[model samples]
Target: MTNNLLNENYWTTRYLNKSTAWDTGEVTFPIKQYLDQLDNKEINILIPGAGNGYEVIYAFEKGFKIIHILDISFLPLKQFEEACPDFPKAQIHHQNFFEHIGQYDLILEQTFFCSLPPILRSDYVKKMIELLKPNGKLVGVLFGIDFQKEGPPFGGQMKEYRKLFSKEFEIVKLEPCINSIPPRMGTELFFSLRKIQ
Candidate 1:
């Protein structure tokens, strides 16, 4: 059932048809700012469901080497490789995030969570926990508001997120995104959660 929503063919078709409205064409300001403040350039990082991956490019430009870019579809990964020809080829994984394996010091979430169907939220959280090293952090933004329309960019709120992630992560910061882009302002939550042992 869930596979039907996130089926490889479905997302691949979306990219092929240019139906991904979630492709911002640029990294969101909140995520860029979050990366700007992180000084550790060598930490192992994973960006799952990384479509277009503007943020990953931004991080790489700033000297992060151990970054893994994972996505379910091959289209975006190919595009990413074209854009960053020198990016480590081995780190670009064309696979399902749930099936992929790795321990990372950080995982960056941009619009990935909202892209999944609502039913997979719990599983998403569990997979995130399993991928992080002890005390590893997950940082990024989430939609603070919901879209009434059916979505590849689904919507969620703090209450549901807290309940879903609290079992394996400490919600260090879950609050309104004061610096969200004008279109996303007031509708976004910037969060930084640390994995719990």
Candidate 2:
């Protein structure tokens, strides 16, 4: 799809039509394991393009008080609010990710990057640099293989990902994921990159 077509209206329409095949209905295993190991619950965390916000909810329930969720479409944010009523309403952001401003100690990525048009990949790297605190981390999974169809769920290989992110961030870990859900088993890469000072 064209960049213009991937706006709030398009995503909102997807939610309205219940067309979200990407919604796994729960936190995926790789991310869940990563969150489970985080020692600091007090760190500032952001989950942008957080559809239905399963990870946000999981973090909050685990005692992470300063977590935030952002989505371009208000529909998923509304659903997130309904699902997580006690999450601070002020922390729920309804805006474009590129327009968002905040410094996070940790930013959780799930399907957000692939959903963007490939043309925005550089912008995404720049924005991650802008959004992170010095030495901050960006962690989560990305598709490690190409798909046969056109995509809102676009895919890429580790070499391209490393090339794209390594200039501004230290590639702490970027490897084929061993813990993906069955359907995504051989297709995902779990990554952890730290912002360079």
Candidate 3:
């Protein structure tokens, strides 16, 4: 499918039809552990394409007050608002990630990357670099294997990922995730990339 087909309407329809199999219902293990290890709750954080805002809620409840969640679609953001009314409404952004502005101390990647068309991978990296502060981090899991079928849950291998990201960021950690949830156990790589100065 074309990039245009994967726009707001595509995603919003998926949410409306309850076709979001990617919604894990709650924060996943890898992300939960990464957030758990953070000693500084005040660091500015962003979760782009944060459908349902699961991690957003989790981080807020844990005292990370400066966190932000962005999504192109409004339905899930609306749902998230109802679910976490205590969360500051201004911090919830209903905008396209590529058009988003602001620098973050850290950006959490969940299923967002793979959800985009492969053609946008480089643009995704560029936007990430643009959005991060100097020496800031982009950390999360990525699929470590390829899928046989076409995907919004598209997959990729480690070497290709390394080549794509290493040009602009320091690959702090890019290896098999030992803490992935059961179904994703051996298929994901837990990565931490620091924006190159």
Candidate 4:
């Protein structure tokens, strides 16, 4: 946690004050499309930094039962509980992403990576590898442009992301996102990486 501003209290306060502009209020298009094409319903899944658990709701509704949602801020988790009362309570985790320990068959990356200070990007990659089962996939979208201001929505280019992730995972898909939400349209990269055996 080198970035003091990214700690739990900071995020909790943002949620408390309704400052979460990163939230789209729905599962973004790229992740939803990726999940729709997956055939397996039994694999264990983890979504780290799962803000409102929108994707968790989508996955659960689509018949994926073994899903987990983790967040540093309990505020959103509490709201998520209210939104999906039927989702198993045990599957909702309030914890730091780096401190979480579990093996997952799939790890979905949403806005989590960019929310951290850019210095923690390598730690994020290493932790993703540690959390995944052998051959497990890490899939989702990343911002493809460098932001003009300091960012919880920090952004980076494709070449930098590819170089960073390739150290631990086999780069499977790292390209411009064709299905991003309108505001994010040309600025997002859809990616899938497999943990190296």
Candidate 5:
């Protein structure tokens, strides 16, 4: 990870100090719309880099119990546990996303990708493919504009993201996010990519 780009301690400290500006504090619109259309409740789902875990709570409340939440820092996981006490303790994971071992039918990407070094992006694509079951989908939002500053919320353009993710994932959906929150309205892209067979 880049020295300036927030890694485990950087992110953990953000949570510890309640300085997580990236945190939406609740499920955002694009993901919420995606979840609303889901007809199956039995598919195994995973959300890595799951800080605050509002989406996990959203899914759990809507009958999606076969969900796993992972984070590199335990701080946010602890907060999530308190926020949703009924969620299974076993489902909360504190570990690196690349090191996590599990086959998931669906993996939701929130703010995780941008938090790492830009050089790790390709590896992120490959690892997402590895963690998924055949035909499993990696669905969520990505920043669509490059930030001028060094970042944990590092951003990139659509063409770059499309090229990076194409090698391992079939580009099923990668477009400007129409339903993002006000602050993120024009800067986010909602994507859904399936592991290539």
Candidate 6:
């Protein structure tokens, strides 16, 4: 189902038809706040499922020299390229997240996790562990409420996330996001998990 439902064609079609309700057009509050507090400009960072990646642009503008953005669909990556002409083309990875192999000091998640099939959640955790350097982090927001609709914007609760992630990570912060966008307010959880040895 994942190979069919959440594949490149599915997302590429979403981008072509302007069906991206998840595209916030700018950086959302929780992630922006996290980025604002980062003191290191040289940290290796990766943003996967980074559709029209506003966070990538934001990090680059802040002088982060090692920012990589990946999208299975080439559509959003193309859009990002046109939008940020100075960003190095080599840094944009047009590939599947599961097939991506690299180490990062930090991996920023926005809408990527929930977009995957819930059955692949375990794979997501394992792959995250593979991608992070020792003590590196996976930080971002996740849906805190169950959605009434069938979705790529799938919903999940904190309890499930805790159970799934705690086995492999040091759960630093997994709580209600106090600074989500107005439409998503009270429905999101901000999380920061450190990879365990």
- What CA root-mean-square deviation does each model show from the true structure? 1.1, 0.9, 0.9, 1.1, 1.4, 0.8
Per-prediction TM-score: 0.96, 0.98, 0.98, 0.97, 0.96, 0.98
Cα lDDT tens digits, model 3, 53-116, are 9999999999999999999999999999999999998899999999999999999999999898
What does the lDDT come to for candidate 4? 0.92
Candidate 1: which pairs clash? none
Model 6, residue 114: C-alpha shift (Å): 0.8
lDDT of 5 by residue, 1-197 (tens): 57534357877777788888889889988888899999999999999888889999999999998999999888989889999999999899988888889999999988888788788888788888889999999999999999988776889999998889887889999999999999998999999999999
- Give the CA lDDT, 0 to 100, for residue 117 in model 5: 78
What's the distance in Å from true for residue 30, model 3?
0.7
Query: What is the per-residue lDDT of model 4 for residues 109-172, given as tens digits with 9 covering 90 to 100?
Result: 9999989888888989889989999999999999999999888788999999989998999998
lDDT, residue 40, model 3: 99
Candidate 6, 7: how far from true, in Å? 1.7
| Per-residue lDDT of candidate 2, residues 140-169 (tens digit) | 999999989888789999999999999999
Q: Which runs in model 3 stand beyond 4 Å of their true positions?
A: none
| Range of the 10 consecutive residues with the lowest summed lDDT in candidate 1 | 1-10
In the range 1-197, model 1's lDDT, one tens digit per residue, is 46765678888898999998778898889989988999999999999999878989999999999999999999999999999999999989999888999999999998889888888888988899889999999999898778888876788888988888788889999988999888787899999999988
Alpha-carbon deviation at 122 in model 1, angstroms: 1.0
**Residue 91 shift from truth in candidate 1, angstroms:** 0.7
Candidate 4 backbone clash number: 0
Compared with the true structure, all predictions reach lDDT values of: 0.89, 0.93, 0.94, 0.92, 0.89, 0.94
